[model samples]
Target: MFTSQEKKGIFSLSLIFFFQMFGLFLILPVFSLLATEEVEGATPALVGLAMGSYGLTAALLQIPYGAWSDRIGRRPVITFGLLLFAFGSILAAMSSNIYWLILGRLLQGAGSMSSPIFALIADLTRPEVRARANAMMGGAVGLSFGSAMSLAPFLAHYIGLSGLFWVITVMSLCGLLLFWLAVPVPDQDPVKATQPIGVLLKKVLKQPNLTTLNFGAFACSMGLTATFFMLPMTLKANGWERSDWWEIYLSLLVAGGLVMVPSTIFAEVKNKFRQVMVGGILMILLSFALMAWAWSSRDFVWLMVALYLFFVAFNVFEPIFPSLVTRLSDAESKGTASGVYNFSRFAGQFAGGLTAGILYHNDLPFLPLVLGAAALWFLVRALGFPNPVRHASPVEKPE
Candidate 1:
């Protein structure tokens, strides 16, 4: 289904994505603890800030990075982004305080390469095979998330957070090496100046189909980050030692992946994209509801089931959402459209972290907030998502 060059592009890009995402996830299971315990003046809010500051920078820079890639080339932009990411990892590794850690995270996010990566995939693959390519990239991200969760606790137990950051720095450099060595350059740069920036942005934002998918991305990310902001501490309080987190996450993620694989195949191959997407959103809502119920019960089994559902739903949606965005996008402005989509996603990450932090600090309910957001997401999808096969079709120029 893919040419040799296409295979190289997918493999190299997937590796780039895996390394970057793994670096982020490697810290998620332990960063809050590190912030509160090791860093002086680290309040719950600061901990949340440290966890999410990267998203803020990523959200802000996504569009610019995408646009830059369109103007220059994907290789240079990605290389520069990787360099920045590595520098941030080094800074984070050396941080002595919470504030510095936050700065490091912000710098890490500043390397925003998601749009360019996806755009490059769109550049390389035929439309018929694009969804599969996207699924591969999404699978890379899901695998990285699972691997990080499984390894984080053990790594932290031995090398500590600083050492983990150093590891991330090394991994990022490896990604850079892979990018230069393995990924193919596009035969020709796609024309990006055909549409005015204002016009393209307006079109992308105004399309109901695109908007729905973008909102879904936002809600999914928001719920994931917000839940994690509180989950580690909650689990620890519920008698699960930090060392044991890997076991729970590994089991849930594996089960989730098992489900995700078939669902993705059903969506792409069977052409049930809309149905699968709706089912995925409903699954997310159900997961949040379960999480809300589990919060007060403090039952490890209940929490495990809730998270299992969450990961399943999340994995199902992650690949499909971006594929839909690419499919719905005008070929000319795919980079811009992807930028907007990623902006929505990371913006949600920033919001989720802030919301979780405030709720935690103020002694308010967090699960209910996540549940409400999930409910809202469901409503948006039910009312707005189209039923036509248009979303699964090849990319088209805007009318």
Candidate 2:
């Protein structure tokens, strides 16, 4: 359904996403342990800061990056972002202290490539095929997540966290090269804004449907980040070793992917967007509840079930959310809308990490965190998310 150039663009961008995400997620499983063991004067709060610092910078910079891409070009912005990312990776790798590590993570987040990359995909693909293109990209991210989970322990064991950072740096540089060589330049003219940034932001925010999806993105991310912040420690406390983590994550990821295929097809091809999304949200809520129970009871089997369900729900929503944003937005403001959407995502990441850190530092129960996630999901469902498939073709054109 895609032209050769479109195919190339999709594949190139997918690789860019894969490498970047892979590098970012590679440290998740071991970050808390590393902070306490290696870094000077590390505490739980500091560990959380290091873990989430990237999201803060990324959230703050995403809109600017997207706006700049509109002013200059996607390729230039993407190239610069990749370079920044690599620099951050190097900084992180060289860090001998937690403070420096936090700074490096902030720099990593400052790159904010997601907005421009999605905008570029919108530029390259037809609206009809945009969902498919996004699905491909999301699948790449899922694969990267799986690969990172499977590889992180081994890599950390063999070479240490510093070595992993170096590997991330190399991966980002590889992304830059792939983007330059593989992705074609867009033929479109520069975007001439019909309104100021404030007005544009207001307009996007005022779209009830878009706002619903944005909230969904935020809530989902918040749940994910918060869970991961505690999951590793909980697992360790329950007698699961770091070496065995890969097996659990790999198995869950594979199972999630297996279920994701049919769910995605049902949502996209069968035009059951709302049903699928609602189901996914419910699943997320249930997962959180189960997670809380498992954590409290130290039931390894139940914890695994909760994680598997979380992954399944996460994959279901990941691709659909971005495509929905693109579909709902006018072409003129796609970059802007995408920036806002991504901003929400990163903001959730920041909030989740910070909350997790504070709770862990205070030695509080995990029940609040899980309950908060459930509440957020309930709010998303109450917002009445519209079905993109119902309006897909007609809304593809910009207003």
lDDT of 2 by residue, 1-399 (tens): 899878988998999899999998899888888777888878888888888888899988887777667666778888889899999999999998999999999989998699999989988887777778888998898899889998988888888888989999999999999988888876665364566777777877888777777777777787678768877887787788888999877886787778677787777787777888878877877787787676666677887788778777887878777887888987667777888889888987887788788775443446445545554655556446656545455355222
- Each model's lDDT comes to 0.79, 0.80
Q: What is the lDDT of residue 22 in candidate 1?
A: 91
Question: How many clashing residue pairs, candidate 2?
Answer: 0
Candidate 1 C-alpha error for residue 252, in Å: 2.3
Lowest-lDDT window of 10 residues in candidate 1?
390-399
lDDT of 1 by residue, 1-399 (tens): 798878988888998899888988998888888778877689888888888888899988887777666666677888899999899999999998888988988988988689888889998887767778888887788789889999999999898888999999998999999888888877766666455666767877888788777787778788778878877877777788888899877776787778777887888787777778878777777777776666666566776677778778878877777777877877666887888889988987887787788775444346555556765666566564664453344563222
Residue 51's lDDT within candidate 2 is 87
**TM per prediction:** 0.93, 0.93
The numbered model that scores best in lDDT is 2
Predictions: Cα RMSD each: 2.3, 2.3
Predict model 1's lDDT versus the native: 0.79
